[model samples]
Target: MSVNEIDEQGLGPQARRSEATKRALLDAALADMEATGEASIRITKILQESGVTNGSLYHHFGSREGLVQAAIAERFLGSVTKGLAVFAHRVGEVGSTEQLFEVFRDELVRIGSPDVQTQRIHRMTALAAALPRADLLERIIADQGRYFDGAADSLARLQEHGFIRFDVDVRAFAAWFLGLSLSRLLSDIDPQLNPDNEWSEYTFRALVAILTPAPSAH
Candidate 1:
C-alpha cells in the first residue's frame, strides 16, 4: 500500500494487521469486550475466538491481563492514528491556527466512529487500570504521544507559513487541540452537558476568533 494509505488505515499496515496471530488475538479481545463489556471477557473466549494458542498468547502478550492491556492500548491508539491521518492529509490545507482548530475538530469527527462512545469508556478504563502497570502505561502513552507529535509537526508548518501567528506556541496549541478532541471521556460524564453539535460549532468559531494577526513593521 502507499505510505498515506498505510498511515490512514491504522498505525501502518505492519503494526496494525501484519501479525496475523497477534492481530487475531487482539481483535478477538476487542470484539469480546465490545459485545459483553470487560466484565464478561474471558481468556478462554478470546483464545477460542482467535484460534491462537495459549503459548502464543503468553509469548506475545505475557498473560491474559497483558493481552487485555495490549488490546485496549491498540484500540485507543488506532482511533488516535485514524484522526492523525486526517491532519496529515490536510497539512497542506492549513492556513491559520483557526484552520488548525478546524483540523482538531475534524480529527474528533474522524475518530467519532459509531462505537466511539464504547471505545472512550474502554480507553478510560484501561488508563485507570494502567496506573499500576508500568509496561502498559509506557505502551499506551508512547503510542498516543507518537501521533500527537505527528499532528504537531503539521502545526509547525502552518506557523512557518504565517498562518498560525507567531508567538503562539505550536506545541501548546497542538496539545490543547488534541486534549479538546480527546475530551470524549469528560463529555460522557453527563448527557445534558455533552452536546456534540453545540460544542463543535462553538469551538470552531471560538478558535478562529482567538487568533491575533501577525504584527506589522515599517
Candidate 2:
C-alpha cells in the first residue's frame, strides 16, 4: 500500500500526530545540518527549531544519532529516488537510440555542472555517514536496490525497442551508469583536475559504444 494509504488506514489520529512531530524533527535536523555543514546536529537546537519537546524527540527517534541518520536517509536517498524516477521517465519518452544518447549526454552535462556536483558531494558525504551504522547502511542499500531496479526496468524497455544492446544486462548497466555519475566526486574535490567536457565526451562515447547493438549476422 502507498504511504498515504497506510497513514490514512493504519494510523490513528494520535499516531498521525506523532508522525507529524517526527517529520518536523527530521526537517529541523536536516535543515540545521545543511546550514552548518555538520552531520551531527545539536538536539537542543533541533528541538527549538522544530518546536517539539525533547521527550518527543527521544520518543520518536530514540536518540539524536537516530534522528540525524533518519534525516540523512530521508533527504539524500529521497533525492536520489526522485532523480532516478525522472531519468526513467525521460528514458521511456525517447523513440530512438540517438534520442536516448542525447538525453544521456544532457544528463552528463547537467550532473557535471557546479550546482549538481555539490549535491552529488552531499550524497557521498551522507553515504559515508551511513557506512558505520548498520541500520542506516541497510536503508541505503534498500534505496539503492530500488534505484537499480527502476533504472534497469527503463533500460529493459529501451532494449525491447532496439535502442540498447540485446546482450547487455540492464541491471548491471544501470549500476555502471550510476557509478559513472557518482565518479564525478573525484573531480569535484580537486582544483586542478577539472575535465568536465573531456570527461563527459569520454563517458558519452563509452556509453554509445556499450549500448549500441551490433549489426545482424547474415
Candidate 3:
C-alpha cells in the first residue's frame, strides 16, 4: 500500500518494475519542469508520461510532493556524486592538486547550469529551512560532512604539494569553497534568476585567485 511497504518486500520482478516506474516518473517530472519552467506538476501527467498505472505510482511514491522531493534529491545529489567521483579518480591517478581542481571546476559548471539540478537545489533549500526534526537535520549535516570530505582530500593534496600556503586550514578552506559553490548552484537553479553572464567562470577564477601558492625558486 505504501512505498516503504513495496520496498520492504525485497527485489522481485514486480519490485523491479515498480522501481523502474518510479525512476521513469521522476525523469518525466524533471523533463517537464525543465521544458515549461513549471513549479507545480501533476501526478497524473507524470504517470501518463511514464506509462505507469496509478497504483504503481502510489506504490512507488507516497504522494506527488514526496515524489517531487525525491526526484529533486536524486538529480542534485546524483550530479554531485558523479562530479566528486571524477575528481577522486583524477586525483588518484595523477596525484596532482591542479588537475583535481581543473576537473572539479569543469564538473561544477556543468552541474550548476542544468534546470533540473537548479530546481532541486531550490527544493533542498526550502526543505532544510522548514524541516524541524532533529534526526532529519542531523542526517542533512552528516551528508554535508561526507560531501566535504571529498573536497577536503583535494585541498590536503594541494597543501602537501605546497600549492597552497602552509598556514591555510584545509578543512576550513574546503568548507568555505563548498558552501560558496552550493549557494551558487541554489541561485542558478531558481527559475526567476537569469544567471547567463559567466557566473561559473567568475567563481572558478575567484577560487584560483584566493588559493595562495608558495614561492618557487628562480
Best by lDDT: 2
Error of 1 at 109 (Å): 5.1
lDDT of 1 by residue, 80-199 (tens): 776677678887687765676666677556545566666566666766766788987898888877876887787677777777667777667666766765665675567687446666
How close to the true structure is residue 213 of candidate 2, measured as C-alpha lDDT?
86
For candidate 2, what's the RMSD?
3.4
Scored against the true structure, residue 124 in model 1 reaches a CA lDDT of: 67
Models, CA RMSD each: 5.6, 3.4, 6.6
Candidate 3 deviation (Cα RMSD): 6.6
The residue-by-residue lDDT of candidate 3 on 129-194, one tens digit each, is 326545444545555667678877866776787766677776777778666666665456577865
lDDT of 1 at 115: 64
TM-score, one value per model: 0.76, 0.88, 0.62
Poorest 10 consecutive residues of model 2 by lDDT?
Answer: 1-10
Model 1 local distance difference test score? 0.72
What is the overall TM-score of model 2 with all chains considered together?
0.88
Residue pairs of candidate 1 with colliding backbone atoms: none
Looking at candidate 3, what is the lDDT of residue 16? Answer: 75
* Of 1 and 3, the candidate ranking higher by lDDT: 1
